[model samples]
Target: MRLSSKHVLVLSIASMAGHGAMAGQAESKGFIEDSHLDFMTRNLYWNHDYHSGHNNAQRTADRDRREWGQTFRLDFSSGFTQGLVGFGVDLSGYTVIKLDGGAGHSGQAGVLVPEGNSTAHEASSAGANLKVRVSETELKYGNNLRPYNPVFAPADARLTPATATGFWVVSNELKGLVAEAAHLTAAKDFNSTNLSDDFFAAYAGVASDTVDFLGASYSVTDQLSVSLYGAEYKDIWRQYYGNANYTYPLSDNQSLNFDANLYRTVDEGSSRAGDIDTTAYSLAAAYTWGAHTFKLTYQKIHGDQPFDYLGMGPGTFHDSIYLANSSQLVDFNGPNEKSWGAFYNLDMAAYGVPGLSFGARYIVGRDVDGSRMDADSPYNFYGSERSEDHWERDLEVKYVVQEGSAKGLSVRVRQATHRIGNGASDASADQVRLIVEYPWSIF
Candidate 1:
């Protein structure tokens, strides 16, 4: 059945109303009596230094952009009204205030703040969702959502999170399995209130109204899970994704883990994205002993176009494209690119500090096909010479209050560096971020 965006919501509400009328009214009181609300405050300090890798005067001049900001986040989720089909609502909003950003660095200093001449000092956004549940299936319509699927996993790396106007349905009736269908109409960028269809377009650069996806995930055992998904950007491209994760205990204090992801994309309909066809894969393995863990990863892209995913924000949380080299500073993804990574993680609890943790990771990518880039691409200077290489290193430490009056307070420090050769897609930069957050329930 075809339905306009407005009709989608109307139909959902109608269904909920019909279901509520049939179910016993007394049971529906739970919707209001079991509601939940929370408020959280977060403070962030970020700094970045950019330099030239090839003496490009333009890229060289932008340096040392710094910004500080604070955010208040509010969320409320209502329990569903008891019925054959239950109804509920979710409300969320965020407000931010810029603390510092003394103009100089291209306003990109605060990647999460909408930039004015320097950077916006304040911004806020709010969203509400109406949801209907029948058995284990749920349908929702709204802006703020967290799907965690391969196609549209919105970014939360910034102060403001990505949001989209859309409708979705999910089912979890089957044990250890979830199935989903989503349609997104428009998206708001991470830092701005403005909605745009072209926000995440890069290849063909054409923006479309609706993006649709269907996916299913299954947890076969306590230590194994798998997912498969397919998506289409109307008039652009169609993509399929697959993922698997597994963990096994090796000994009393040791364990091993494995993860793999694969994606296939092809042009759809009129091929607005210009005959898109691409294949990408990522694989990782990890071993943990006591409070220490080590990991290795490999990633590769096979196609004319680079492996890319949808994101209204600047970037997704971790390896949005399922690539090992998607570091804090750069996603080492380019046409025909291949990358490898190594990482280590440590928990201070082993040494008596229960709420502290540290981590370090390094990724290197090569075989970038700069030659294949057309006018739509970034690096036109180099062609298939494929000599472009880039590497990134990231170090992070974090501490959280485990107990006491200040419990739930967390402090994190992150530093990273991206060094690139001549054919790289992005610039070389050094970044440092300090974030502190104290979350206490306001409900």
Candidate 2:
């Protein structure tokens, strides 16, 4: 059903009227409501270079660029109705106003697209989303950013793309069970005002014209959970995924967690590979003690090509970078490649500094060969290289104001340095990010 602006208003009024009538009769007349608002600003500095055999020969000497900019974001979510079949709405929106930098500094990076060539700066449309919900489920509509394993709409970068036009149903109707399904069209790549012209375009060896997916998750026990998912992109490929995670207590103050993810994909009708099949997998473990967490992950790609995703992946977290220490880069983990990551986090809040924390991680890639770059596919992060290796280190510190005028205000500082081994094109560089965020609640 198409709902014009007028119809939406009328329906909202009618819903309120019905609730009033019930209230007068002593029936549950009042619905609890809560309002949430969050705002954040970030200052970022980036420097990158493309070298021979890196990113497919996009070398820094030939196309080196550096960028610095600031980004602002606001988010809001509403509460539901009071009754058994409650109704509610949620909103996620943000705008990017370029502070300084342009295409000349073009890694294009994550936020704010250049207006002309790679030198002009332009403001991007504010990404926004609206969602309606029932008892324990939600029907999300409009452009929103989603960050999760698999199909993530990145929002972690200085500026990230916002996916447009999609509907999803998310439910937790049964104990320990969760399910979701969606159809998507149109995407606003981070920092650009225009949606991708290829939003639903299909390619023989590249993107699918449209993307459809369904997923379900179940918790078998407090310490274990499993998930299954399937997806199809017309004329491209069909993909399936399975994931499992379990937690085990090792001692009174420590625990061990294990996680595994696997994917199986096959080219379908009109796909570039006709009937080719591919697989990718990852395993990770973490041990946690009071105030400290140590983690390790091993990833592998076992096909003749890189994994394909809608636009790009790994933007689902506050700190995701392709092939980086923490970001989910599928490239380094692509066909015939193996990678490892080791990281640690410390929550100073547990010791004394409430809302203070620090963390660091190192990631290494090996046995990566890009000689098989998917012809004409820009999706490949590695250029035409026979073998590659690289490592990155990241450090971050954060603090949140606990009390006083600035109570709830949060600040974070992050730094990263990367050095590539032979056959990689990415530049050796350093990055620094500064961010401040706050939230307000209304009831």
Candidate with top lDDT is 1
Task: Count clashing residue pairs in model 2.
Answer: 19
Cα lDDT listed for each candidate: 0.74, 0.59
Give the per-residue lDDT digits (tens) of candidate 1, residues 202-272: 43345667777777899999999999988777777788999999999999999999999888988776765
lDDT score for residue 3 of model 2: 50
Candidate 1 Cα RMSD (Å): 4.3
Per-model TM against the reference: 0.87, 0.77
Candidate 1 stretches greater than 4 Å from native: 1-29, 53-63, 115-119, 195-199, 202-206, 313-319, 373-385
> Tens digit of lDDT per residue, candidate 2, span 125-221?
5545565544445566666646344643334555544455565666665678777766666555555556442332211224443556677789999
Candidate 1, position 293, lDDT: 98
The C-alpha RMSD in Å for every predicted model, in order, reads 4.3, 7.1
Segments in model 2 whose C-alpha atoms lie over 4 Å from true places: 1-32, 35-38, 49-53, 56-64, 80-93, 102-107, 113-130, 145-147, 195-206, 272-276, 312-331, 370-386, 424-429, 441-443
